[model samples]
Target: MSRTAEEIGRTELGPRPLPPLGEQRVASDLSTVDTVLSNGLRVIAVHQPAVPMVELRLKIPFAGTDPMHAARAEVLAATLLTGTDRRDRIAVDTELALVGSDLDATVDPERLSISGNALASGFDTVLDVLADALTGAAHRAEEVNRERDRLVERITVARSQPGTIAREALQRHRYGDHPFTREMPQASDVATVTADEVRALHRASVLPRGSVLVVVGDIDLDRALAQIESAMAGWSAEASAVELPALPEVVGGDLLLVPRPGAVQSQLRMSAQAIPRTDPRYPALQLANLAFGGFFSSRLVENIREAKGYTYHARSSLEFTPSGATLLLDTDTASAVTAGALLEIRYELGRLGLAPPNESEVDTVRQYAIGSLLIATSSQTGLASQLAALAPLGLGVDWLTEHPARLAAVTTEEIAEAALEFFAPARFTGVIVGDADQLSALRGLGGVLMP
Candidate 1:
């Protein structure tokens, strides 16, 4: 008779240690061609041959000083492709379908972004439709009116959401009167915007001088550049795109409480000033954040979610902009546990600063950081999106290619220093939104800043 399977395995060998990570290798083979058109449109084409599809991203600086600009831009983005001089909405849709393409437009405080994809063979057709909309978007009275009503309805619904309320409250508390606070415009302001105003805003604000276009796919880079140039030649303006003023630096202090009279759950939000990607210490800080709370296995999650069952999720991440960066921490929990969760979160922050990560902790986060970067840029759409996002910051494909090495080079000592500087509990301030009755528990926690 044969020996039992378990007995054979136990006799064969004891438990073995995991193999060490192999030497780092660059996985991306993307080669790019960068060019500028006569009308000042910056075009970047990357050759990625894994798929027969082309991904496109257009970023236009769309900032405005008028308080009503956000509301109007919201409407403009919704109705921009509804109709063009050459094609009504139906015709536009039909043409895009023929090419297996789709395009979407959205505007935020920083830029108006257009992203889409199509078959590599249909790249020219996609570009043609894009150019026509860019130059000849009719902003038809009927389309604008219909979209404006829809926007108001959506805004109304969004305002009723607890998350939206918390975000709006946090932004208001953080920025005060800064234009960035207008991320979601007042429904009343949106209600008053007229179609004519959206048309005029489009005419004045949409220009090519400060815009960037990134195209990625399996195609001849030179031919793609020529096609883009010819297609967008008609889309021009005498003035450069409007650039927003710098965002104010975030200052951290006591937590602010925003009461929601009788809610069952509470939203916890916190943010601290952070270094931009260009900063020399950014890679170390990135690793430090990961070890603290940036991933599922981080200390915050291990403590609050796994150990205490205070929440199902806890995470921290960096939000980058052309002007600056902020590290944000978010979690939601039952109103009863809200105070306890906050206290534990502060404890983790203090622990990270005081004790820092050991060699094993640093190694795990470093591997995760490098691995995530490679995974994010592994596809055509992913690469295109990453490049487009970095373009406004004057970074390019090289930055994407080289960042993994920086993450790998970050030493344990560097991460310790970054943690002591950035992860201190006193470096964060935020708002807590919960039921007023339940928040009595938080009063004893101290450092509560009331509005």
Candidate 2:
């Protein structure tokens, strides 16, 4: 009554061969103006007319080591556009809506980001509102009070989440007491933040020097540049925005098993230092990571998730910062299979280095990488985001336009070397959070430390 997949494929012209991926297309160069405003803001404007909308991404380095910095930063971001001298919260929202625009502001340990999009015809209106808020945001007492309360509630709930628990454990294990580890402020800290503190932090940290603004869409480069310069003339700071201190190099050793009293599953997070995008070997490393665990069909995902059912998914990716980069591998599994999953991950790491990707494997990942880049840049917002991300590293459209060729040039031999150097099991350190009683299997695994 039923036939197995193997049996069904056997009669279908002997197991169907997968179709070959189509040839990759190179992305065109963007006409861009990369300039520094008189007030010290780095502005990158690109004319990408794929659509009638313009996208804006403003990145301001907002790092700080003070005990209250994270809480105040959170509160400030939440209330940034709530009001200014010329307009109140409702007025700001109404004007943006009239121009078919939407904007949002968020902060992390390293930076404050303002991202938005608007109809190209309303570009000047969008810039006007952004400039108004940057120079004159009031951070009114009522607004700050409301957002601070909300932040506390959100942080309280977030702390109880397993993923949050795992992330905190991993960050602590990697860098003890580093400000970067302060991904989210404690609820108690947020509850104590005041409007005056928020305003003071804004004046001191929300600066222009060393910050970047990326504008991309169907707009003239010269006109956009002039508009941005005129709009932001009054938003100036004598001091540069703060930069997060360099992260301590993650030394390779045993995976730390962080105890969670009644957890049902284990969250595994591991990291090791790696080269930056500027390195010539980065393309090879990218391919190696993808083939190992960065994609669904990779060795780790196939072995642990598809074949063994140890976890739903596994990912190995490169995390970049202006200072450097690191390779991070993440997955979650039932406590019963945590050890097996770690073993498979390490085994695959070793296998990738020793066996190397063959020509066929390299070709598949190469195509995927090239195709992914093309698709990502196929949109105005995507292009703007990409440029914004690269701006901090002093790269721009040239690097993006030339990346496909670089990836195409990476060889299997190079990828294998990258895999060996960067993904070695001994070079990785991490945390596994789960019930102490259930993860006893990891003790005998020899690589992980049990609490």
Candidate 3:
């Protein structure tokens, strides 16, 4: 006989003892990484004798303080691949094709990433071409114009989608007049960007002092460093500064409604601040988050989706970054039933604070978090990126290896304590995009509605 959800919830295999948490293990398998360079470029290289390919990730940090900058950065990154002084885009394409290599560039909030993968034999050529594109690429006016047109078209199409609209609305609501809130570039904004602006940004921000070059491959560290320095020797560090003011606390006790006409289902996003990556409570909180809403078998999924069929999925997690962090919960439900779903969400949050999870629930969630962490460490490429990313944020080399033990050490009582401090019913914020009339119905559940 199939067990009902009520049975599953109440079925407690009593007195299941948990193993004692062990010491944090440092990953000795990862090779020693060093930082130095010729000319003024900085480099971090790892020698993986087992793999024949190499990956180089370069960060360029001058794109925008407004939405306009976002558009400009995208155009500049695209233009990098179009050509250089030595080769046209087609010529470069032919060379990569011959070597079975891949090269691309992308822009993020803080920097531009230029990465390439190629056979060990052709690594030097790939590096030479990439360096040329970075330091002396021609930012042709014609290519800039074409990129601008393409970006404009993309923006127009993105804004028409309901999901994009909902996300944009949330950003404006959460980070008013802040750069972090900017999601996409506007057509008008992209059209106004000048080629000179792009050139100046490339010159000022994509230099050594603010950049970190990560190379992972099968090669001698000394030779790899030499090859990188020979190419970037002429490039010098430039003045680059980013002053991100503290984001204001997200306003709570309000319902943010964005009416999407003719919509059948409602998308709900709610969030509040969580501890940062460097916080001591991170491991415990991560485990608790997974149990609550971080995975497929989370409390949110069990209570809201699997049992009640209110939505297809529900999730929650801490968005960690260098500057700060936030805990976000998101799901979808029928527009008419949105209020009922939110009430249940609030109820669950309240319940988690009051009742500690039983032994079985804690053990299952702990095992899942540990398994996920282990999986994240398996790939050399992924491990290298995570290590590099965390090092910048002051996390130690032992962070990953030590994480599983820390997660295991978290008691149900401690998780309940974290929930009390982290999840605040009074401060929770909600955003809804659906029919205006339907959103109004939510006000009866007790909160102010902000349009």
State the displacement of the C-alpha of residue 324, model 3, in Å, after optimal TM-score superposition.
1.3
Better of 1 and 3 by TM-score: 1
Clashes of 2: 0
Model 1: residues with Cα > 4 Å off, grouped in runs: 1-24
What TM-score, over all chains together, does every model reach? 0.95, 0.96, 0.87
In model 2, where do residues sit more than 4 Å from their true spots? 1-20
RMSD of 2: 3.0
lDDT of 1 by residue, 1-451 (tens): 8877666556346744456878666655667987788999898899998889999999999988789999999999998888898999999898889989999999998888999999999999999999998898999989988988999999999998889998988888778877777788888888888879988998898889989999999999989998998999999988999888888877889989998888999999999999998999999999999999999999999999999999998999998855889989999999999999999999999999899999999999998888877878888888999999888888889889999989988999999999999988998999998887877878889877644
RMSD after CA superposition, every candidate? 2.4, 3.0, 5.3
Per-residue accuracy of model 3 over 99-175 as CA lDDT, tens digit each:
66888888755667777677777778887788788777777788888888888888889888877877777777777
lDDT of 2: 0.91
Q: Say what the RMSD of model 3 is.
A: 5.3
Model 2 per-residue lDDT tens digits across residues 322-382? 4888889999999899899989988998898899889988988998888999999889888
TM-score of 2: 0.96
What is the alpha-carbon lDDT for the whole of candidate 1? 0.89
